[model samples]
Target: MKRKCPKVKSLLLRLLLFRQTRPVFTEEEKTEFTRLYDRIIQDGGIAPYDSSYPKFRFLQYLSVTKPLLFHGSNYQGIEEFEPRRQTLFDGTYTDAVFSSADGIWPLFYAVLDRSGLTGNIRNGCIVSRRGERFYFFSLSVESEDRYPWTEGMIYVLPRDSFRQASEGKLYFDEWVSEKPVKPLFRLKVSPEDFVFLSRTTWHRSTEPLFKTYLLYKWRSKFGKRK
Candidate 1:
């Protein structure tokens, strides 16, 4: 018999120990979820859970490990929550796909299963010139702006602006541009919830006051994508 690695054994143990705090979705609840799911894709994002989400205990435990760091000067003031073993959050803008084959996979998989919906869980990738990818990562800010505990905000760019960037007509030297353009949307969320945005969406976060988790890119086949 082949012996399992230590990491695999630890993951399996965690999976068995972790338990869901809420009951699974009911048929009626699933229908309502479907309605909400439709609206999220149309708006280019969705929050699958609210502050009332009961899985915080397990998520918090999962976040105890050291976080991955982004060496880029642009990401200097940010503190990340991506664990060392998780390669998807390496801080590069590189494009790629990941599998739900690890222990962390169930964290997202449970969310998807709870939704009773089908879609591709596209992880982080390069923000394509033609607006072709979506991403996921959890982060917090270490700057003075976060004097008290306050959740950061996300500023989303309009599709047209994204197109301009894609076409090389515009450039974002920073995470966001102060050049006044109507915001496509703005979001403020807690780690208790998960959010997913579309390829055409351009976003940046304000100072995060505490450690947070981000799970994104539920690209539905019936929805839109590259």
Candidate 2:
């Protein structure tokens, strides 16, 4: 759906923005998340995210504070995860094993099109407790005409081994570990499963992905206040 919040212009409008970048879920979402979390905790057999050979869809045990954490990458079967200085186009963070509370937030990384002009990829994943939605729009809308589909995986690791290092105002889902840590398991995902291109309604944003990020952050932090 095309949702438009008040422009981030006036100081009063800015007051509507919340400091926390992580998504703030609803009460019903909280209850549903708890149920899904408990069920996933009890079940078994969740693994892999190859873009070319996409397998089972990733489950949404979507939560930000639970013991389970996720890390997305193009590689697979990561026996041990070590920390490093992650440099991205948006910004960079210190050396640490990074992960997220939202299960699908990592999928963007897992199945990213590692092409030459990847900075403009249309693929978008919104990290929130309520389903952690994925935003995929038309390739020929206003910018590039081609989008690539690549292979990737999501590593599921235990949270006890790491500490929450969300120092910035726009990455509350991120978690960091200083020492090497192994994942509990991995899930394979593909574009078909991750981005349901058929019936989903999507919103297009020409604004930089970072601003789109701040948009979500604003929703997460202040949307809950009455």
Candidate 3:
């Protein structure tokens, strides 16, 4: 029997592999960042719930660890819920991974089997250059419940201009003109569908909605090269 593809699923498969390459941060910087990260964990007072799983209680203990990154200063306009942090790579940033390692991309696999209702809101910006771009990919699987619309967007700017904006020094009047180009495409994944899409063409998410227990994973060269 031929399996049918959901609207979002089909679109994602077609776009996942396309990406624009850009300069990445140096290894030394990444190492230093990791070192600071460890100190944050220790000073933040994150108690060891189960030593077997060093990061088992991250989501439950995020408030104590929020000091590692500057508050609303370094990277502008990105918001993360408790238990999440902005991770710097090269010069770009993303939500930190709880347990990312070699051969493992940050992957979130959630099973929503409860009857109660819950949702997640994700908002952020994607900065790309004329020749530099980023690819944001996501895959979702649904159960009997329906899947919600997930929003994604992207913004492009001059290399020098982006640097200023990231440092919270960009004048609002000037930065407003640097909004991202309209998305190349948008689609919906359903219970019967498995979807994957890439924003490598310059896009970002604008408070997308996802049902509880949704399964998610983030894969990048950082995970592969390590």
Model 1 residue 178 CA deviation in Å? 27
Candidate 1 regions exceeding 4 Å error are 3-12, 15-23, 45-149, 152-187, 191-226
lDDT of 1 by residue, 1-226 (tens): 2244534533432332222222244455545545643454367432343323233222222222211101111111222212122233333342221221111222332222212222222223222223222224221222212221223323223322111112221112112122333332233333223333111111123422121111122222123222
When 1 and 2 are scored with lDDT, the better candidate is 2
Clashing residue pairs for model 1: none
Please, what are the lDDT tens digits per residue for candidate 3 over residues 17-94? 333233343455444435544554454322222222122122212212232111111112323213233434333444
**Model 2: residue 1 alpha-carbon error in angstroms:** 31
TM-scores for all predictions: 0.26, 0.53, 0.19
Error of 2 at 46 (Å): 6.5
Candidate 1 contains a number of clashing pairs equal to 0
Show model 3 residue runs off by greater than 4 Å: 1-24, 27-35, 44-104, 107-226
Ranking by TM-score: 2, 1, 3
> Which of the numbered candidates is closest to the native, going by highest TM-score?
2
Lowest-lDDT window of 10 residues in candidate 1?
A: 66-75
- Give a tens-digit lDDT track for model 2, residues 105-185: 467677755554323333333323333233332221232344545677777788887776543222245677888988776
How large is the C-alpha RMSD of every model relative to the true structure?
18.5, 10.0, 21.1
TM value for model 1: 0.26
